[model samples]
Target chain A: MRDGRAISIERVSKKFCRSLRRSMIYGLGDVTRNAFGIRSRSEVLRPEEFWAVDDVSLEIERGETVGLIGPNGSGKTTLLRMLNGIFWPDRGEIQVRGRVGALIAVGAGFHPLLTGRENIYINAAILGMSRSDVDRNFDAIVEFADIGDFLDTPVKHYSSGMYVRLGFAVAAYSEPDIMLVDEVLAVGDRGFQVKCFKRMGELREAGTTFVVVSHNMHTVAGFVDWVALLHDGKLERFDNVFDGVQSYSRLFLGDGDETIEKLTSGGQGVEFRDVTVSSQKLKPGGSFSLSMSCESREALEDVEVDIAIYDTRDPDLYHQATNSAFGQRVDLPAGKSSLEVEIGPFQLHGSFAKVAVAIWTRGRKESIFWWRIPLELLEAPHAAGKNLVPTSFRVKAAE
Target chain B: MPPSDESRQSAEVVVYRPDNSLRRGYFSLWGDIVRELVRNRWLTVQLVKRDVGAFYKQSLLGIVWVVLIPLITVGTFVLLRSSGVVAVGTMSAPYPIFAVLGVAVWQLFAQGLVAGASSLAMGGDMLTRINFSKKSLVIAAMGRTIVSFAVLVVLVAACFVFYGFRGYDYTPTLGLALAPLSLIPLLLLTLGLAFYLALLNSIVRDIATMLSVLVTFLMLLTPVLYERPVVSNDAGGIASALSAITEYNPLYYLVSAPRELVLSGQVADVGGYLIASGFSLGVFLVAIFGFHLTETRIAERV
Candidate 1:
């Protein structure tokens, strides 16, 4: 409501129908037959209505850097389009305070036949900059983009890297009050990305508000101040950046279960049953104890257990270890058996998998039962509260 | 109210979203049409330039191709007249001169109509990004035709000098000089029909493919290359209806005015042409109004 706030979305929802039949057949014969006559044998398909963005509201203050993070099909892009006024919401409203600049898709306004300079004017006009404004900033934009020799060449001739560089340079220098960036930072090479990150930081300091949506948690963690997580057409969590990241990680972990009773039963010879973790405090890089249980119809010998820890934010397995390599064995009789395991200091900050269970008899080595339990690692002792400083930078005084 | 807990609490903020309000009244609606057209002016200019450029780009004769096509068509018809395959009225000027003027005016109408009809579908990429004035695309196409038509007019003047024909009494009177005035209404009618067909073509692509054949038949129906009297008395009772259609056809008046000015050396039935022009203007306005009503939904349909 305040004058300084740049953008506000209030109770907005959007619905799209599945069928386009009504708009397709436009003739007097069809209209008369459908409107006044008896029903025909051929069935007319009714369109199914689906809500792309459900009732949601948020306010973005001037100069604030906000990030939106969510899984695929989570309506993040839908919300961004509504913010950009590309798609109107079926209900509620959106108010924008100043000139809005969108880098929704890089090179979106470019024409293949037009040269770089022509595209700059056309693209800027499409982004809501008048011709006079583009004229004043033309030199600065070209210089910042650094495509000096290629300025007159057609955009189709430019490399993908050159295209993204020019697009970012034009958008960043527009001095917009609100910028909506949709995962375009991953466009250029590593060095250009670093340069863009630095430029964005400077723009933020000079009072430009940005709403960035990205699947890359590392980029979101480094750049944004606040984050909102959307899932299945609804906002799941909106708060500080770290909490939103945590909620996002949890969604990928599936519903949490203390015991593995819901897992389907009946494996070949060995049946893996349950998993559990015992910890005094769940701090990052801290020690914890784990226990696992399995049942076999017959006694099994030389059984091994494999435990792997993976950062849920990233799908790559970070650490994997097996009990057979460590000289440990499990003994199971006909009905039930239990094994105790222990590990220290979880390294990853987001979500980690605590998978452990018994693997049966040699070559075949089928799993009796396995557990894919997820555990969250909070910031370690001194790094407990809000705004934990990253360990990457060091400041020095001038000589 | 003091700054108590109730007062200090955050106020409920309201966001104002603009409704599709261009859907009301004639002038307000026309304003939207103009705004949409102006927004796409760059695209319009590019399309116009591309069209004119493409006509001359790879041709062996280049720009001369513009004058050559009409001259050849007129020459063939004049040969037909000499062989008794066609009959000519004892007009003041030679038959070639009369036929060539008719071709020039018809070319303007034909190019404008064909280009206008396809303008929307041609700029399909621009339509997806932003909503522009649909009618303006048609108008821009007509503007492109006008440029070429001006070249054709100059060619007609050159023909008069080369053939040693009597100059159509070079008069400074505004009415004689404004002989091209009749084309305005024809342009409007072409633009109106183009808007309606362009929208239709977007939905039913088959219409676009069939349009050229339809246009060819319409050209034969209009008295473009020949005089109306030749076809007025033909057989198949349909000729009477067809003659009435040609006589009342707005484009007949449009083509007749320029022919009257150049061939007969006098002003044609000005009142009749004016009425046709007015009627065409009304069609353009109605077409634009209909286009504005449906444009908002175009994005979804496309």
Candidate 2:
């Protein structure tokens, strides 16, 4: 009940039964008990039931935009639905200030046989817009949706992109105090997504609190002021965007050292050990140094080393530095040999990246040893696209 | 308590908690329903417009089905009556006009109950996604029944004109104007049962299928198509027992009151009609209270 708090969720939990028959039976029992004014045992778990959202508490202030990001079945949607009041929590309480416009499913109640102009009113009404509110914003909504020629056509005839555009436009124009947006933004084209983010930015400036659930980190990372990371129906971290994204990336990729043994199988007597980095973290325009020791059973001449860096979000090889590529040569004596590779002042997209080190013979055909190192990326600039490159923008008068 | 800002701020803040049934005060829950229904009145209208428009738009027969259904039923009953296969027993107005009028009023309840019972289940997709007042869907389902009944009223008017042209003593009175008022009790009762059925049907769909059959059987028990018989031993054991059941059936009073007013300009039992209306109002109030209590959990079960 604090001033300026838009939404306060206190230790909320919601459970779902797996078996359909048992779920229905339990629903009947609970409803019957509810009818009699008896409190149902909401705190206890029944058979075939599991908590979909467990002991998650969050306080969202006015005008703050918080992102709910987690993998599939990670309770992000459940938490969003609870905020929207579609599913009341089985335990604890949720207090919401002002009106909530939930874009849980865009075009949710639109009759497919109805035309776009007709459904605009229906969808807006469902989103909690009064009649006059829709009337005032009707033209703006249509202009924002930008499905001009197809506005008179039945929504069933419109493309999926057009349908989503109209739906998002109505909900965005509803002028709610709190907006709950799900992954429905993924349906629209790139231009429409940009328009939506711009509209959301405008709403944020007007002090509309937002709780958005999206798996697209590139989208969520740019827009959200803070991120709540969830894992397996539990809230893992609620922190700034970088910390939460790094934790989410770690969860997604699993422990890095375990994959080293499986990734380096065909080693020829030279084992790469103690692969250490100068710092585990680096900014986009900063460089990091990696050094490793190679133990060889026999002396080898003209050996080569290669270090490949990959963005952890998308594990495609981003950049590689090789001794041969740099016109350098390496010679490894019998026992212990040390090597250093300075890997970048290069730019990357996500908050975490991984580097793989490999040693090759003179022919560059056979590998001597390989190792993987996980790196923490910092201050990666958010942009419209996934690429975060060092660039500058200038504005000048057109002469 | 602060006076001016308290009401406005309290109105703006919404608190959602578990076990709502225990927290709700009796009078406040009633107030909440009225406020919510008033607030979402436009949503109810839109749902009705969407459903009714989509229904007719998709059907090739369109509005003709409204008149055709009662016509076909009346036609079969008239044929049976003419062949001496059935006994209607001393009707005041023409049998065709009488039967069609009964069907029109009876359908308002039957179709409304069926529609309302399935409203939540049919809109399960939207129900789970959005958080609008659930009563809007049930009330909007009743809107379709109103439209269908309005269309059937035209058919009933045609029955009166057709029978009147043949000199069958089918002259109507000013009571026809007040005829729709008699259906208030029937509507309230049907809506009350529909609220209960909708909640149950969302959990176990068998309630809906079972209700359709039960409605058909109840139609036979109520005197919708025939006159109410006195409990006499000479009518046969089953007939007497059915007449006995009809005497206690609330639907008989609800259906016959409006039909008698429309046909003869007076109700045979004014006391029975008043009692039935009062009973329906009580059921409606209690059922709505129960519905409002647990509607928050419906999205999950659905």
Candidate 3:
């Protein structure tokens, strides 16, 4: 409704000093120069200092939700800090239209010795809320946090979940013009997380601007209008959520890790040349089969073939088997060989999830070959039923 | 109540630009820092309360330590002077009362400096995540010492009454009337040093360790328990050199001037008092300017 954009970042950059002694010495030199009325350029880096965030620029229209997605230490956090004015940019300028409610880290400014109630007030004030503003929203914050009687108890006694919940509640309930959230929702329980998103949804509808930094691609795709992918302190892509996520997935795998290649000189005499999936894009419960080609350099008996599917979203969601479940016996011939494996429908929630296929020799438990395939899951026609392990892997040897 | 349409208009129009010149805003930096601190006044108060509250939260003696630190310090000197182990040659007032007032006044600045210098590092997680002015933390940490100084005020009052009963002439005069005002200069000096020390300590932590040693050594050098050493023809060696240089120690004027005013109802060395106060004011302005420039880089260092 105002005459301008909600946030504008222009060529913003922040430098970090790696060594304590060097940082101190530099600070002293700078301050001493300041004393004698000398001005120096901060854009260039000196020794032991590097740019954490380098020459980044962005702008957000009022009421838009943007997601910042990147790997650890890629400067997403540093960029957010710059946006919030926590870390003043070394070289660039930032213009914010309204107060920033930033949950940079859960309970970042919370004094452990202070009561949960006291912290809410202090944290609110730190976030640019006035005392009376906090007083007005105090009840709602307490209700949303659900701390109950623990409000009077010191936050040091609070469980991590409770601490995060209370912290999130204060920031969300403040209803600032722009809210910068930094992966705080991951700490809460599932129910609280759901509630937080629902609250965020309502806020989005209210024309509140949001810049959410998250590693969860599904959540980002669901919640944000645009996505900005950061790689190694540079913006790789700033586009619609889908394209941005695709770029991020590609970057994730592009770290000198070749996926489509022969692997594992199997001691059991069988080696897998390559594994391929029919399609990288699929709906939940969509039918897709894996095909593999391999060969045995040495003659061997009972060289049972083994295959596995590893989830990229969570490593724990893995499935491995030596025997085919579809009744066809897995046999790798002593010479060049190939197999087309078919199985049940895949109910994977993939969009950004990757499936790494691994082939192995049974009994010897020797890995034959493996490659990770980044999967893109489209929205299901109907909400796929409550299947935690959505994709099931079953293999039958080629005819 | 939720933010009304009226409150929604509080959106500030900001300009994001690259800083090509550090000199561009240096003139307005002072005004900007002051305005920002004023806006965060409530947060400053909250932080001060939290620091003072947490200090004694688990301790058995609790707030008693506020008075106890100065008391124990003054008591040790009093014992030393009375037992002849350390001869403090003086004739101003009763030794216990004279030393306690000086130590109490000195403690206000010393404690504030230590607390304020370490405040940034103490706010470890906060220094990185929150978007408030670091000036508030320095001011608030310095503010926490006021509560302990208030406790010391009560002790000083009791000392005055006890010494007055013994005919030591602890009389209230015009100088005594302005004695509390002397704390203003002392406070300015403490906070000025604190502002620079805190910023420096964030970059190099050796400032904190060095500050502790310096505060103890400086306290011994000042004429707190002992009278101002007379630098005459006969006075030579360590005594004359220390006494002559002690005149330059701002703490000497800040501590000794007000103590002289409160106990003896006299403004001893008024020119020195004015010089020290003016120097402190200069330090405060310089430190504040330096702090403004360095604060932008503080998060990185901290």
Candidate 4:
């Protein structure tokens, strides 16, 4: 409750060497220099070294949950380690209040030879639980873990799921004021994950501050109060969950300035020059339009256009459309011409979608021009199950 | 598992800063060291329990190895003496009893030092991912060694009882009970040196391989298996040099004082024993303080 700040990191950075042998040698030099009270050259980088976590600053208020989402090796884990005090930052400072529980790695320090019942005490102790605290909650931990018959068996024999379940159970039951979770929830099965999320929600309601690192954007958007997006070890955006996830998806699809290259040859007399979307951002069941310009060398009798929407994260086409299927024909004059397709109020709930547009002759096998465009969408609130369909529900004693 | 109100209010707050040794005053560092040790004492006990249990879990002999390792070393020396391969100078007691007692006392330091030195290297997994008082790892490893040493002491006791019943004119004085107290300096010296070595070993992989060879070489120079060599002051060349080295060697007094206490109910060189104990105490205090200052960096190195 001091200053109402649970965690504060100021201009922190950590450097790591690339070569293993050289890293150890540098460690020796640093240890020797520090032992004699000589300050290390933290300001400068040595050869083969780079900042794993660059200069970054953040402040987290008490009872606030923030999701740290970024691409691989973007310094999310490094930042988490620094917050947990596992690795000391070479520059700047970090201050944390209250008791902390870290799930940096599930089943960290578990002894393979020890039984599940025995390792619970050891793992919990390492996570900062006192003996009496563990003793008081031992039954709850066992029940939460749900590895009923294998409690007496050695942990080495437990399946990977059971192992993760036990590890997460001990840490969750430790009841820390500040919890740091790093990609641990991805290991559990669906049913167990639901239970884990329920437990996390309970903890969140109890005023536990959380810093979760995950790549699942939907989970991040739904669970966190705010989101911090990182790129190349730097904080790119810190905003509400919706905006943060949008930028993350945009980043995943590369910069939006990519020139639309044609996937098929545009024959003479009919060629597409440009394409644009009405709105890049859309809500669930929202209307949007796609417009394209065509440069004609001469008059065209009949033209057919196709629009296909592809999910950025999946391989198959999400939805496709053609003007010919709807028994529509278009006639184009010579010189410059334009065409626009209004597709609307559709059911789409994802971070980003790729739209592919192609123009074809009525009887031709291949389209003359094909272009792909990327669109960002705000996910539907409280989305569940495989499809994102907007619906309303009402009940009054079934009258 | 919801925490009680009192525990929540009393929760600890930790702050991390760069170059902590230079940032914090020396007095504050000392206070931090004390607090860290006291707070993590239970973790040390749990680590020790895990280590000792896991060590013997797969072995067929289990606890017998603790008794067997030192006896095997003593048996090799006893065989050497009987075969006339090497001469062990005259001793006041029977040779097997004499050698076994020397080996037991020596193993307390040698075994503890080896185990303690590898503590950090052996915990590379926990060190990289978890943040706790790392000194607990070294202390816990030494605790496992102490468990083994206790078994050796029982083996030594059984040897004395067997020899006495065999009518070899062996008589144990009450000083045997006080022998363990005299070995306290040896434990201190081993732990102090182990702290420095463990830190170095964590940074440099070669230190561990070098340590085993160095320990064997050091044992030859100390008076563990044979009687303390008597050399006159004017003896020239290697003899005089060896004499000077032995005189300054703290291990000599630390190892011999306890062995003499077990044999004659008295220490032959009380002054040397006191000085060795004082020197060991100084090394332990200074080394542990240095370890506390550098422990936070261990994670990065590992």
Candidate 5:
């Protein structure tokens, strides 16, 4: 609608609170403010409030399939919702031209009791398809969904695969100018997912814009022209798919080489100044010293560190942790101080892993600094004692 | 028009920034809601069909429950009146038929409100994940009630034919021809309350629970089973005070007045009934606007 640009999101930001009670109060306040025409000061973070998507500006031209790649809670889904016009930005402008067909979650609006045949019409209509459009594409969608006899059965009785297949079918058939998909594509079995991707590629050929948010690297890498990499509510990079995806993979693996990621939450005055994996090329079973130095404006006492190593490919796949077996306490002087922990004389499964380091105080209950960075774990020829994590961030309150 | 199948995927120009305050101006909200509802009309129909289908699916009685529930309710009253256990005074026709018609109309209002009020909250799964109009869910929740109301209408019609054979004047009159028009007031009143209740239900959740209890309590208090109490006589205690309070209930006008107009062509308390209808309509409009005002924020809370 905007001369081939179906989505134009400029400096968009959305904030969310974790506490349900506070969120409800904030929700009520927002509604009241909306009614009385009052705009709240949103630039500053209120208590328990954090920006989900901060200063993110992205545009999608018609007929383009773009992948949104990021770690969990990095605002990929939030950005997709903004593109779909479901969540209005707190601070910026999102102008989405033409109709948007959003399949953010699996079977988002599908009524389980409705027959697959009936649900297709409803889901299609919800996605902005006219009745005739559904009628024309009805057979094609059913065939694509492959819900033959189940077409007349209530979707509740159908398997989850059938549900997603029908849901995706209706959405794809709706043929919106822009389609927003969030991890929902992964819910369908691999075969159906391939079919969906193939179908989406064909749809893209038809002038439809596609902005997809997914954690699956292979799927994101498949056919997208560009990949927007999100990190902590910010659009870290929007690069050509190949390059963008590589960076996204690095961002995920916390592949800390030449890049420096300052740990933000190390309690205001105290911060994890830098996290260093002292190995240029890490052999999986080889020994390496991992060190983190925290600088505090205040002289912090009894401040221990909590560090974890994770498979960057999968953040949830934590390879190791310092707190669990090797708990150490260190004192940080008023000025900058450092600590080092020896890692790996034993085997590690992944060749690419990252370290999440945090500085905690008050009996390890409070953390002043936390940051994650990428580490390169090379495949070792021998799996012999390579998995050893030498105890302590040996920073020794260095004077 | 559907997009042509030849254009290739184009790159997106996404710019993430802070604080664009001017886009969501309060004035545009109503316009956006109206636009969304219009776009979602078919979604509303589908949801309604889904709801109606779900209500009877896998049940032994199935759609028969639609006719059976009303028959049992009216059947009890018919038995009570026949055995002289309960004297419901006099009506233009048989008391059982009059009572049955009133109960049928009352269920539409009571059940519609109970269901419609909770539609949004009950649809938390869909509401959170989907971008369709919330108004569609509220309207769709009425589908179950509508299905039963249709069955009730047929049953009422059958009663009229049977009574007519017995030489009683239960035949369709000019008033009966206007029955469809007469139902508009009741439907509007119930739907209006539904908009408010559905919105409120999403916020507090207790409203949904409260409504089921409230509907049951109000059903007995309303003149659905018996005639509107004789206010002229000095009826004492609960009967006297309850009659006075019931006089003001919106449901009385919706259920009692409409049934009266259909069955006997009489308006019960013309001024009071007119005022009630007008108030219900006004509330409905206000409730819709209230819903529209808060709908954007609703998804977050639910």
Candidate 6:
């Protein structure tokens, strides 16, 4: 407790009590019955309380950038609010050493009836800025928000994007010792999102401690030094950014496949049976092969079997071909039969997905099978330039 | 590495560390509260200004409504006096003037009580975001009331001129100058009661709705529109008990002090004012203490 660490939470737990009775009966009947001594089982039933945030212990030092990543309802926002002292935990202690700034929900303090200019002052004050401080920073906030004419108009009339921009501008310029950002960067277009991340990077360099919660793995990987993964109101893993992301991706991808399988079985008739990949025996940046097989019970004809290969890093479909275009057809013999397809010379250094399937019949098109087979493309040692796979193999080195 | 290059290399190396300590203490708590309040001063001013501005925002009558409502109330009482429905007492000033002054002072107490009680609950958003002095909330509510009361005072003064009645000679005497001084304790008491009620209303929402009903009945117990002395003189069987009740009534003394100095052109009742001030101060301290005790749990209830 004597060091310059900015935040510390020890054995914190919060519980909320919920009643089982409906509002119509319980709300009105409870008032009347409780006034008298008439006790009923439903009225006297003790409230069932569950801890929303379980025992969580963590320490954040000054000038550290931490990323919070998890699925929705993982108590990330709750923990941020607790750090800001917005909600007190039922048990344990939290100590914050400096001025804490939180943008848990952008535009949370904006009133619909108030004009943007008025709301700036009001919201600034709510964020712990004095009147003089707001006056000094007002121009910069407005400039960053880029809302010139709308500043004097009621915020209710502004578009959702404008609300987010204004909220972000005010919060970013607040310049507190510690800042908590929660999923606000996902708002607006891709360009604005990039600008926000860049600005956050600048702030991170200026000795500001940042606790960011985002589902965007790329942003988390690029920006944060450390990451904490939460699951079902518990901190599942806390580690360096790369390791945390790897663990998260594995958990996320595993869950995603299970959920996708569930959706596909629900009256889609199409299923992904198996998927596999191949590459040149050895050497980095060498050619690679991908293969997928599908089996169907019914015999199919005049089907278009398409294979789409995409680099997971860029998520762009680099190669695509159909069996019809290649003069091939799937004429299965009545019962279940398998179809196999292969591709090669994969020239990427990241994971690639092999999406293959056969499409037949209009309106109620039946999928013979689909597979999301993964392929790892290695970089060739000789590949030097951007988009480095050479058009012709003719090389001479000075000896 | 060269000296300059070594320094440049050191600058690029990022250090990752964690701090785990609490800063400052209770004596500096007030500074933190002040900083939070200053940051949110805009919200406080806006809320206070809105309460004042809404009185004259869009209506054709605008600010006149403030004067007109009390004037109309006095007009109704005047009609009752003219029709002989009620006996008129002989006084140094016109009956309407006396009645209107009583109404003006009563409005201060009522406004202070209602607005102060509802202040924190009304600004629930601010309460959850940052911690500030709860006293500022009461101050904002009182500020709104004071603004309206000041406007009303000017109107009351103008009415006195219109009726060709010379304004009471207000001099800078030790006693006469202390007329405004009497209101301090009363203000404190109202703030305390208001804070207490605001906290209570958060826990028991029904209290807010029931307050208006309670206030209406309480108005009868206070001698605001009519003179308590007149009622005491007329009572036959319960005269002593009725007079005792009227003597001890807090509002009776609250109204009497101002009326004595301003309209009647006499020194204020010093003994009566002091006793009332003491009572108000006592109530204020108790109410504020109760409010602070209950405030920690208000967010959960709200």
- The deviation in Å at residue B126 for candidate 1 is 4.8
Reference-based lDDT, residue A181, model 5: 81
List, residue by residue over A103-182, the lDDT tens digit for candidate 2.
77888899999899999998887777889988998898999999999988999999888888998888889887888988
> lDDT tens string, model 1, A1-399?
676677788777765556555446532222223222222112222246567677778888877898988899787887886676555555667876655667665555476666789778766654555566678889978987889899988788899888888888777766666678889888788888887888788777767779999988778877888888888778754556767776776686564433422232336765555555685335665666766566777887765556676654457776787776777765566677776777755655534444443344544356555555556565433231222344677899999
| Candidate No. with top lDDT | 2
The reply for model 4, stretches above 4 Å from the true place, is A236-239, A255-399, B4-12
Candidate 6 residues B20-106, lDDT tens each? Answer: 011233335445445645655665775565555444544658667767877887888789888988654566666776777777777
Chain B, candidate 2: TM?
0.93
Clashes of each: 6, 0, 3, 0, 50, 13
lDDT score of residue B48 within candidate 4:
93
Q: By lDDT, is 4 or 6 better?
A: 4
What TM-score is obtained for chain B in each of the predicted models? 0.79, 0.93, 0.92, 0.92, 0.85, 0.76
What class would a CAPRI assessor give candidate 5's docking? incorrect
Looking at model 2, the pairs that clash are none
**Best-performing candidate as measured by DockQ:** 3
- Those runs of model 6 whose alpha carbons end farther than 4 Å from true positions after fitting are A20-46, A105-115, A150-157, A188-195, A246-329, A332-399, B1-62, B84-90, B130-134, B165-177, B229-245, B265-269
| Per-model TM values vs. the true structure | 0.71, 0.84, 0.85, 0.84, 0.75, 0.72
Q: Candidate 3: which docking quality band? A: medium
* Cα lDDT of model 5 by residue, A61-91, tens digit: 7678888888888988777766665566678
Query: After best superposition, candidate 3 residue A156: deviation in angstroms?
Result: 1.6
Model 5 residue B241 lDDT score: 84
Q: Give lDDT tens digits, candidate 6, residues A218-241.
A: 778777878888776778555667
In candidate 1, list every pair of residues with a backbone clash: A270-A368, A271-A368, A272-A368, A272-A369, A286-A345, B36-B133
Q: What local lDDT does model 5 show for residue A269?
A: 78
Provide DockQ values for all models, in the order shown: 0.17, 0.40, 0.55, 0.52, 0.22, 0.13
The digit string of per-residue lDDT tens for model 1 on B1-302 reads 01122322332332334233332345675676677677667656544554554445446676587788888878887888789896655566556667777788887777777777777677665554432344545667777678778888888777677567454433334554566765677777878878777777666666666777776677667777666654534455765776778667888887777678656556556787788888888888877777665544444445
Candidate 4 displacement at residue B26 in angstroms: 1.2
Over 4 Å off, model 3: A17-21, A34-37, A47-49, A236-239, A256-305, A311-314, A324-399, B1-10, B16-27, B164-169
